[model samples]
Target: MIPFHFTGARVLRPGGLIETPVGITEGRIVDAPCGRAVDASGFLLLPGIVDPHGDGFERHLAPRRGAMLDMGDGLAMLAVELAANGITTAMLAQFWSWEGGMRGPDFARAMLEAHAAVAPLQAVDLRVQLRVESHLLDDFDAIAACVERFGVGYVVFNDHLPHRQLSEGRKPPRLTGQALKSGRSPEAHLALMQALHQRSAEVGPAVAALVARLPGVRFGSHDDDSAERRAFWRALGAGISEFPETLEAAQAAVAAGEPVIMGAPNVVRGASHAGKVSAQALIGQGLCAALASDYHYPAPRQGALKLAETMGLEAAWALVSDGPARVLGMTDRGRIEAGLRADLLLLDPETGRVGATVAGGRLAYLGPEMASRFFG
Candidate 1:
């Protein structure tokens, strides 16, 4: 069946706009200005978004303070929201750790099984990208097993603790309401962090060794704070920098030919909530390569529109969609093209509210309930 054909929308394709029609078939773009039309006048059509970072594991596997929801529920809700925002592909950041609670081995297992059951049914492209915390090295074997089961696509080395330690404990600190609710004093928390820091150091070598063999999986580094840090990660075979915390780190990644991602929230908020480097600053310097929604699901789309409004249309749109897709090796979906993936987002050009989102040429998200009505 002809999947879909949207007309009258400003088509974002290679080299620019297409005042023509789009032919979507078999979940990929079959041709351009090639067929029938689905009314989309006054809308700006764009490629489906690509999001590489977001710790949804925490939200789904561990929803509240000491409360863990069904793995399926979290994934379900996330799928809707993601598709709504034109995110045709989402990399679920699976946090694996030997630590108690959220990132525990048991939780990881549940996640792996859950993904196995649902990823295939997703409306948008869904893949698992293990977010490995070196401190969680004790669970490395189990993690490897899970990756094999999930056909994992990517892995990101996250040493938040180590970076904080080097920066004198200044990074976005973690907070488990359970811990605070348990009446764990601030001193106790500090002690826990220090212990976690030590644990991270203890298993670094083993994690390094395991990561070396997963060549099929692309590797990334998280929260890079400096040029040296970027170089160090690149040396470790992690060529993508996820949310580099400083402009210098982003520049270093660019210099090394590594794609650097920034949080979409950073772009919308104009800076990091954690007081780190601003996404705007990085974008202005041409140091940004990708955009991830981070904690908020709706941020990516809104951030893209905001970035476009501020940084000119072409550049802003690239940060969230084409740019990230390019870095992730998704040559098929970033922009509208013949023989590419038919992932498109139709937006009300004025407010940028997503009017319709089609994945694989199927309209997956639309109108009121289809999108986060708050922004877009």
Candidate 2:
């Protein structure tokens, strides 16, 4: 690969934004141009986005029920999708839940194996984050074993059980469809749900044990709804609060020095689809630490530009780039700096569109108007 000397762009650096050109050599930023020169006039060059959590790849992996595509093929396309949106690093959130089919443990294991097979050839840094349903007490040992087998690093606890309705002996909506999806009868599903709910007292010990066994992986809790719940996860060393459902929960996480992650799609759409705490409102109040792509691949860039309404572009971009990198304990590639990885995004300032993306010093994605800059 030729060293890239990017000239005439406003670059984001540690000190702030500067109009000076920058150079990339051997996958790191350098002081002088060593090879080809690319005229990047009228562009904003920012750090490549680092998405800490996202389940958007689900569609690509399994476009429809029982109609799964080849993992390698799907992942290759996902790389392009992510690079087009300026994401350099991403955590593909896969679930291990009772929901079965795509979200079940068997599929989770297959996805992990597939990730290992396809990750080396992809442009983006794709990592797996196992989202384990908290009520899966029967799968604790299996989950721990898979964590070691697959070399997975990040895991988050999620509990989507309709505890309130279940406790009142009322069936949650979609129980019948959910059971069919899981290859179970509706009555069996209800029985399983009731049994799991009845064993609520044992959930804490099971979670603590599983978490203890995975010593090196980063742990988080999803959909935190209360300060007390935040405290419970904090006690278990789950330092990341993913999509806190309430302002109080977000405040509690922030107060305890935990990173609060929310969906970038929420910021772009101006409201939460689930009617939880608004991510835009959280960012405005300085409670949100980072933004994930969540269920939409294009959201981070759009969301950051929208967030620029309150905070400046530099700070807003940080929410999708540096902030997420910090949450994942990564210090190498979020920003464009000397001796750091050359992961960058070139954006057309007027339209707020990504013109090109460079991941690990390679030209990964290019817009129609950007060919001249590299080729001319």
Candidate 3:
């Protein structure tokens, strides 16, 4: 990678945007100029986005429901999208659920192995977040083995089963669709849900025990709906709250000093598609600590820009960059400061599009508008 002396852009710093020349050499930001001189008078130099949670890579991994045989190509394509969207560091959320096909335990293990193999070759720093289904007690040992073997540091507990319908012996909505997706018959899927629901008493203790086993792993709760649910996960040593479904849960997590992660799409869409608490509302109340891309890679950048309309660019941008880096306990690349990793983006102020992206002091992406500036 060629070292760079970036001049003429309004650089975003911890204080605010400033007309300062930034330098990058050997993958770290520096004070003095290095190798090449680049004129960037028309762009906004910002830190490369650090996305905490996103599953948009799933489509690239299996675009047509098992159409992809090799994971490397899909991951390579995913990296291009990440860089194009100005994402430098991303946590790819993979599922260890009862759902078969792409989301099964087998698929999770394969994905983890493939990610480990492909990460070294990509410029974007890609990490995996294993989403464990709480009711899958039989797979606890396998999950632990995978975590240990793969060095997975982040884990989130999820319970997507419709316990209410299953407990009442009623058919859950979308039962047929889900069953077909999982390659299971509707009757078998319903029976499995019922079995898992019947063992509800065992799940809490089992999850707590699993959490205890993974001492070094960062734990979080997914889709927390109430204060009690948040408290339950917190009591189990989960420190992060991912997408609290209601205001009460968000407030409870904030009051408990846990970082609350909201979907960036919620802020962009102005509301939750699932009829849950609005992310913008939570951000206004100071309850949200970070905004995750969730299922959409473009939402993080778009969401922050939207919030910048009122919260100021610095604060809104922090929700996607510094805030998420803090949530992940990564102190290396979120801020554009000396001695930190040189992960950055050059955005066109007029159109709000990324003109170029630099990750680890290497040019990861270059848009058409900025191509001539770098080459000509």
Q: Which candidate's TM-score is highest?
A: 3
Model 2, residue 125: C-alpha shift (Å): 0.3
| TM-score, every prediction | 0.86, 0.97, 0.98
Q: Give the candidate order by descending TM-score.
A: 3, 2, 1
> Which tens-of-lDDT digit does each residue in 64-163 have in candidate 2?
8657658777888899999999999999999999888789988898898889999988778899999999988999899999889988899999998899
| Higher-scoring candidate on TM-score, 2 or 3 | 3
Model with the higher TM-score, candidate 1 or 3? 3
Cα lDDT for residue 295, candidate 2: 93
Q: Tell me the tens digit of each residue's lDDT in model 3 across 106-201.
A: 889889989989988888899999999999998999999899999898999999999888777789999999999988999998888888888888
Off-target runs (Cα >4 Å) in candidate 2 are: none
Q: What's the distance in Å from true for residue 24, model 1?
A: 1.2
- Identify the leading candidate in terms of lDDT: 3
